[model samples]
Target: MKEYSIREDDLTGEAIAALLRLHLSEMHQWSPVCSVHAMPIERLRAPDVTFYTAWDGDRLAACGALKQLDARHGELKSMRADPAYRGQGAGRAMLDHLLGVARARGYTRVSLETGRPEPFLPARRLYEANGFRECAPFGDYVADDFSICMTREL
Candidate 1:
């Protein structure tokens, strides 16, 4: 298997910024403006969030984040695999990395909100494969047709 290096990233590089924009653009396209839950680069920079990026040599393969909600909870945020890197295990690698970080940080649970549209099915499937199960809205989220919430115990 091809190797990837995943590490905590500062999100300041041009490539990383572009990837984040792509993630947000795709989310906005699939859901209404108000329903788009992907965080912007600014929000991802908050002190409570740890963002990461995966690289295969010089190429940016994927990115994701773990945001502490409290002492025992964290939320997965802004997971995205570059189009060219899809099916190359980039998404799984990023998810596993973030989950490990959450566990190391003492989080007993991790949850996320993702779009409910057809374009998001693969993402939901990925989370399910990693043990996430459907749940009611979490954090500040409320029930919405455009969103689906999932959670998993660490």
Candidate 2:
């Protein structure tokens, strides 16, 4: 498989729409608390949220977001690797790239909320492999039985 490159400029309107569609079609059912599942593409764009997209050659392979919660804290949002690229390390690469961006932006802590179902095992494992540990819910997320929260201190 080809190695992917993460680029800030790749996060465009069309790319965001594609990502949203992929998330809705495949990953929405994977999470009970995924509010963005049916959200409009335009709504995903905001000043507080910065997005990144991974590219394999000219193809968009994955995308993720970093929402600045505070000067030293950020939240992971909309992390989705395309179905065609699953199990090819694109998801891990995107997470690493997002973390690097968060650290560069002076964020001391980063956290995420994902489902706790069996289908979400790989996602939790990926977060753990990247230094994220189980933590109490942050941001607007509450302590949900169907959701698992993870945080990493940079």
Candidate 3:
């Protein structure tokens, strides 16, 4: 099995920034600007959020974030696998790391908002495989044509 060095990250460096930019660009392309729920770097830096990255040696393979919503709830954010590193396990690695952190933090539930477009199918599949199921809108999110809300209980 392949092992990746996944850890809480500082969200610095050019590679990380480029990955984030590409993530946002793709999100905007598939969904209306208003329906885009992907967080900006600034929002990911909020005190309630913890960001992480999966590294394949010196390369930034992927990144994701867990945002605290309440005492026992969290929201997944900004999960993206670098295009250059696609087909690798970086996205799954980052996700498992984030879920581990959430479990350690005693989060009883974790939720996310993603697009309903074709581009988001792989992500939806990943989440579903990890036990997240389509659910009603969570946190400040509302049900909409372009939005797909999912949640899982710890």
Best by lDDT: 1
Local distance difference test values of all predictions, in order: 0.92, 0.79, 0.89
Tens digits of per-residue lDDT for model 2, 1-154: 4589887752456765777787766555565544433334454577888778888888888888888999999988888888788889889899988899998999999998877779778889999998999998777777757777899999
Model 2 scores worst on lDDT over the 10 consecutive residues at 33-42
Best by TM-score: 1
Model 2, which residues run further than 4 Å from truth?
Answer: 10-16, 33-40
Provide the global lDDT of candidate 1 against the true structure. 0.92
Q: Write the per-residue lDDT of candidate 3 for residues 1-154, one digit (tens) a residue.
A: 4578988888877888899999999888888978988888888888999988888899889999999999999999999999976667788888888889999999999999998888899899999999999999878898889999999999
User: Weakest 10 consecutive residues, lDDT, candidate 1?
Assistant: 28-37
Error of 1 at 70 (Å): 0.2
lDDT of model 2 at position 52: 80
How far residue 122's Cα lies from its native spot in candidate 1, in Å, is 0.9
Give the local distance difference test score of model 2.
0.79
TM match of model 3 to true structure: 0.96
What are the runs in model 1 whose C-alpha is more than 4 Å off? none
Q: What are the per-model numbers of colliding residue pairs?
A: 0, 0, 0
